[model samples]
Target: MTVDTAVIATRLSETFVAEVTGLTISPEITSEFGRSIYEHYLDHKVLVFRRQDIDAGAFAGFGTIFGRPEEHHVVKLRHPEQPTLTYLSNQDELGRNKEMKTSGQGWHSDYSYKLVPGGATMLHGLEIPVAGGDTLFADAEAAFAALPEARKEFLRTLRVRHQYRWSPDRTDPWARWQYIGPEERKRTPEITHPLVRRHPDTGRESLFIQPRVIGSVIGIAEMAEAESTELIEELVAHITSAPYVYRHSWNPLDVVVWDNRCVLHSATTKDLDEKHVRRLLRLTTHGQPVTPSMPKVGYSRLSSR
Candidate 1:
């Protein structure tokens, strides 16, 4: 598709998504233009911008329109020139992907374990695979809306625990990949957030659970251990059903952005090996603190190895 003088947005799915075209993001982008894009983002939880061939810096700049771009916790994955942007590639320095595999295989909302979670996440597809490497998103807002009134009430009164590294005894592939040093672990402590999160901008409640990746409902005083575990498993199954899910296949130069507040996403490249390489440039925006004590840290210098 060719760039146009005006941007165009078309509904991708009624479940909730929009495709944006004809806009080129640059240093010259005006505030009005950025605000318009954000309006579309607030309306649709996911926005697919077609043919965005911008570099990492420009991609990071585009991410700022939604919120302040934040550096990834993984220091090695940070782009050299644009530190705010990170690489999600199945390749090493020598371009040999034989031993490399994709990350974020489990469904999760980015930075859900942090004191201040990520507001939104944008990915620019650079290298795409032939068959796999697709991304799946679940509509948390829709899933929460579909729940029974009694269940919703119960969920609203609950608080769930989230930690980047929850358990130390687990021996899984993700555990190896998600390993953090003592300092990094200290930076991301186990925090409790409302089971049902109300979006700051839209003021809509959504199921805020990270069943696979980060944490579980462990802090609710009223719920027992087995009961909380059962409740989390049941809700995860319900929230990820067909009606609330959207699978997105990648295309070269495509920019896909999703609201981290109300969406759960997972990478579908687990079965893929180095032979089928997939690479993406990712930038995440700063999110507001869900609790009173968790202050927003826009940009912080954390030495990580």
Candidate 2:
């Protein structure tokens, strides 16, 4: 079947995001429609496709339009038949959608801890809560662009370290969860990417820092731990401020995709409970470094190593 249809894109935010309508997704989506979605995705950091009632298999197929779908580090949460699709749910039995682990509560880019971070993360809402379960996104590009030229130049010269499950407060609940094992730790060691990362495809620069998994600036002899922490906090606050953010309140069957290189997203658990189940299928695609080369340092659980 020739799937020829025109997709209508309306701006959700002035420049940060857009909503694409008029295209129904399927495993056999035409290349032309897929290309149009990709173009919108690049132009706007986030694209929301309304009312896509597709299964895990079809969602996995739709993800290929962005790039090769990459398996999330959390293996158990992945769909049984479709390994590339992971469940972001508040339910235990993923099959039943009763409740389990709730992912993306923190403001961070997907897979930023890895040497090669994820390029894009797409989520398809299966079951949404009555009140909350909204996802918030910050436009890193806009945040960076808003900074003074002097500050931008300074950020460009620095590299920030990010580690898996590394939190400033060890008491933080996310750090307490021992989901990432020893071997997985070895696979995802401490890595450093430029503070101001230029999108490889777009050549646009964005502030890149995962506050939840962030560490100090590496290779800076003069910068102390306190100074590094202060800097990270400052930048994270700027990137996540209201001016750059777009809050997405999901409805069932809504498919939302965001650019990881230029967008920081966090999940809200406002009214999520046993009675109100919020379940979404998530897929992230493989990504190369924002810059050509980044230093892959060895493992270290401690904040400073």
Candidate 3:
């Protein structure tokens, strides 16, 4: 169902969801919309726009106003007309179902595994099935703010190890760089970052480390890994707690643009056996690497093939 762009513009609110209006064209309106998106991104980590009739190229055109879109070096499948648009789904064009886990199943920042992670991400839903496949986003800024004073103090001075190749189960070969290439593998297996980071634009402290990718807390006792892991897990739990998050149930023409720097997100499980297909075109925004003095943490450079 198409929505009125004017109505959406008038009623948009910071506390609740708002559908962005206007045809996916017009240079003047698009520029204003891009700035609005940036402001909303800083205020609300998740923003959903419904009924945007955007093809891959059109979506890329809208995305370019915000920032240069980055190609998914690992996810080779992209729209032929728009190379910047990464096709995310469990089905192919011929109506045949492919494997699940097209990229969003886990709770993560877009490319936090990389030395230079993604800045923002735009996902336009082309196809969506019934009853499942909603995306959940957690506000890391809110999560960090809610931490207990003692816990915050402890985390402020710590650093954790992160790896691109790390996964919950050693099943997906694509999850590892060895299967991809040595050049790609160079950035895999490990890097270190602060437990707490100050946002480059906002200068607000946030929980920087994520689970699984973080091997252990640096300079801590080896026997303390279990304790450290438990502590981090609790912190993540606090971050994902309800009221600090929003879930977006999709419609075919829905488009979502999110800031990766301050939010963590994941996709809900869907019925893969019923020939259900969920197709989305995604473009990522590039971000500068977190600096040392900002947090005084050690980070080793790994290869990105």
Candidate 4:
């Protein structure tokens, strides 16, 4: 529970978000400091470390402290040299497909549809837009805490099914925001995960329903479609409300680490807006991979030769 006074950890707001300063990151960071970072991460679901000078190698190294880095399902955005790194931006990367623009705009926990979702997802800003490209994160842990006792009991009995290539959910206003093309849709069978699950280390229950990914929501005992739709809308509204949210305005070289298990994050226009170019390096750790795990070394992951 102790951190070096030289390094300061300050709460970003009343929410479960914090900012840490006075520490430097490298591929080979001291185990003690990395451990401290992990402890703080568990305490605070979101952490901001500004002015980092880390590269792809160091970013992957930092990620492995919690778990082996998980390659994002949308493989096209991955870095050429680092399999664990995802480059998010409106600008293009060398040798990358021109059509692969910034994606993942909707609110979601990274790899939420997987049986086991990721823990920490780190995003380091390389270039930030002049204005209006901020990331919004909602604290699921807090949201769960604020729910009604009876509703919490009911939520525990629900299951959500996610289909990769399924049709858009008419109930979700932003259903078409993240397009899943035909080839990518059939890569995995439908997955059913708990509507409410506990954070691995913290043991606190948080809602896990991401309607953008979850094609259907039903009670384990079989609920009607209209009931399920109403439940999904009710939950989404409750979780994303302002009291549970923290808006992160980016700075160049800022590294943000958020617990995917307890946070629902949405990328602002900077990640996709054509009018402005925004770029960042993201590393996600510890999740069940549908595809083969990307090797941590040697040749990079390339979708096309």
TM-scores of all candidate predictions against the true structure:
0.85, 0.85, 0.79, 0.82
**Inter-residue clash pairs, candidate 2:** 90-99, 90-100, 91-99, 91-100, 92-99, 92-100
lDDT of 1 by residue, 1-305 (tens): 12233556777765677788777667666354787777678767899987877777788888888898898655776888888888788767523243335546777888787778889999999998888889989888889888889988878888888777565345754563245577876776778888888777666678888664334223444577678777878888898888888888988988999999888888887787767878888899999876321223332321120
Candidate 1: Cα lDDT at 60: 82
lDDT of 4 by residue, 229-256 (tens): 6777777778889888899999898989
True-vs-predicted CA distance for residue 141, candidate 2, Å: 0.2
Q: What does the lDDT come to for candidate 2?
A: 0.75
User: Comparing candidate 2 with candidate 3, which one achieves the higher lDDT?
Assistant: 2
Model 1 TM-score is: 0.85
Give the whole-model CA lDDT for all candidates, comma-separated. Answer: 0.75, 0.75, 0.63, 0.69
- Residues 1-305, model 2: lDDT tens digits: 11224666788885488888777888556365787677667778798988997778888988998888987555776798999998777866654332135456668788776788888899999998878889999998888888899988888888777777766565555562255568876866677777788776666778887564422123222467778878877888998888888999998899999999889998876346757877788899998776822233321211110
Identify the runs in model 2 with alpha carbons over 4 angstroms from their true place. Answer: 1-5, 28-30, 73-75, 94-100, 176-181, 213-222, 292-305
Output the better candidate (3/4) by TM-score: 4
lDDT of 1 at 154: 74
Query: What TM-score, to 2 decimals, does candidate 4 have?
Result: 0.82
**Cα shift from native, residue 180, model 1 (Å):** 3.4
> Which candidate, 3 or 4, has the higher lDDT?
4
Reference-based lDDT, residue 3, model 4: 54
> How displaced is residue 19 in candidate 4, in Å?
0.2
Every model's Cα RMSD, please?
Answer: 7.1, 7.5, 7.2, 8.5
